[model samples]
Target chain A: MKAQSDNLVEAALETLKASTLRVTEPRRALLRLLAEAEKPLSCEEIRARSEGEFDLVTVYRNMEVFREQNIVQTILLESGKQLFELTVEGDHHHHIICRSCHRTLRLELCFGGELERYASSRGFKQLEHKIEVFGLCETCSED
Target chain B: MKAQSDNLVEAALETLKASTLRVTEPRRALLRLLAEAEKPLSCEEIRARSEGEFDLVTVYRNMEVFREQNIVQTILLESGKQLFELTVEGDHHHHIICRSCHRTLRLELCFGGELERYASSRGFKQLEHKIEVFGLCETCSED
Candidate 1:
């Protein structure tokens, strides 16, 4: 697990360098946290888990940069909240979040290709897509 | 077009009332703006188009109420901005927005059923999904 996370951080660092982004310490710390996250994290969670290595504004700033470079993806939740995670290597997945408790689980499935084709037929090009699902998880559903 | 928009506003007012929400003048005006929108409007757009009938904080407060009552749907854009619209009856659709020009067009397609089923099989229930597609529109594709 540690080796996999290390590779993810390394790959992300290369992405930063190729994009001419400075490899600052806070940025690296942020990357490590994302690569190790089971689910995407809110900015507040990032600040808390980061142990004061950076402030909330710095987290937001670095996240904005990461997002622009496609090194990070934001999952906009059902409650109008947003969370961030790294675009990990070879593990493309979406999430199903419990609206009741905010418990999240990854779904190793995607259907973006079909959507892209549909958009392409309408004269859209170079398409990208984001999808999020929300529901009552098993325990919450029984409530 | 005006008649359809009026109908939307009326339906939204019903939703607000059903949810025990107040039918304030500012809320009414905001509903009118959303009903007449060709596409979702950002909070800034809401403020600009509202013509000072209320303030941004007021706009946000009303939107939060409407959102809770399912009177409004927020389309989370690829740029990580959010736009608001009335959840128009019998006109269910998603958007494919232009990254370069910010042009948005509605697509008469959705596959939420498949996603919901996938989540359901995983013991989730009462599923809700949101999808947003981003690409260069025809005009911007050549740029």
Candidate 2:
């Protein structure tokens, strides 16, 4: 587990360098937190893990900057709080949030491939797509 | 346009009735606002359309109630504001948001069909998915 976490932090550091973002301590820690998250995290949760080593304002600032640079992606939870996660290695995917357990799962589907073609046909160029599905998970399904 | 809007409101009211939620003036207005919205709206926007007839507290309270009854669904936009939209008539879909113009197009696909099968084969169950793609619209791309 420790090795996996260490690798995640290291990879995140590399992402920052590759994106022209400065390697500040707060930024580094923020990236590490995002990379390690099993699901998306709100800004408050991100700050809590830092043990007051960084200010809340700093976390917000760096997160906005990193998102602008495309180094991080925002995941929305059912609770209406925006959570941050590292952009996936390649290609893009969407999320499935469990209505019962509130658990989140990543679903990779080019399902929107058809939608893109449709848009292009309509002369709506430069199209982008985002999809979210909500329902009972297996555990909640039984209950 | 007004006739179409009224029909939408009527359809939404039927949904509320099926859920056994009592229809009141505020609830009716809220549903109408969501039905008319081309995209999800912030709480403030919902209140604005209510023309000061309903207070913010009422909007928040009714939204919570509506969400619990599955009469509405919420999304956290990239802008970090929580937006509410009417769930489609008896189906789930995603959104394609134009970052430049903030226009949102509804998207429908097979609801995690094959992917859910794959995940189930791997011992994963209770999946939920949300997908959002961000990019410039045709006009923004041309600009």
User: Comparing chain B with the reference, what is the TM-score for each candidate?
Assistant: 0.92, 0.73
Runs of candidate 2 exceeding 4 Å displacement: A1-20, A33-39, A91-93, A99-102, A108-128, A136-143, B1-8, B14-20, B32-40, B73-75, B87-93, B108-129
Q: What is the Cα-based lDDT of residue B23 in candidate 2?
A: 89
Compose the digit string of candidate 1's lDDT tens values, residues B60-137. Answer: 888888887888888877656778888876667888888898888887678788888899999999888877788999
Residue-wise lDDT of candidate 2 within B1-143, one digit each (tens)? Answer: 77876776787777678876788999888888887876788789899988899899999998888777666777666665677887656568666666777666665544467666655653455554555555556677786
Top DockQ model: 1
Position B88, candidate 1: lDDT: 70
> Considering only chain B, what TM-score does candidate 2 achieve?
0.73
Candidate 1 clashing pairs, residues 3+ apart or interchain: none
Among the numbered candidates, top TM-score falls to 1
Write candidate 1's Cα lDDT for A1-143 as tens digits. 99988988998899889976899999889999998987789999999999887789999999989888888888877656778988965667789999988898887668788778889999999888877788899999885
Question: In candidate 1, how many Å is residue A24 off?
Answer: 4.2
| Interface C-alpha root-mean-square deviation, candidates in order | 2.0, 3.9
Residue B63 alpha-carbon offset, candidate 2, angstroms = 3.4
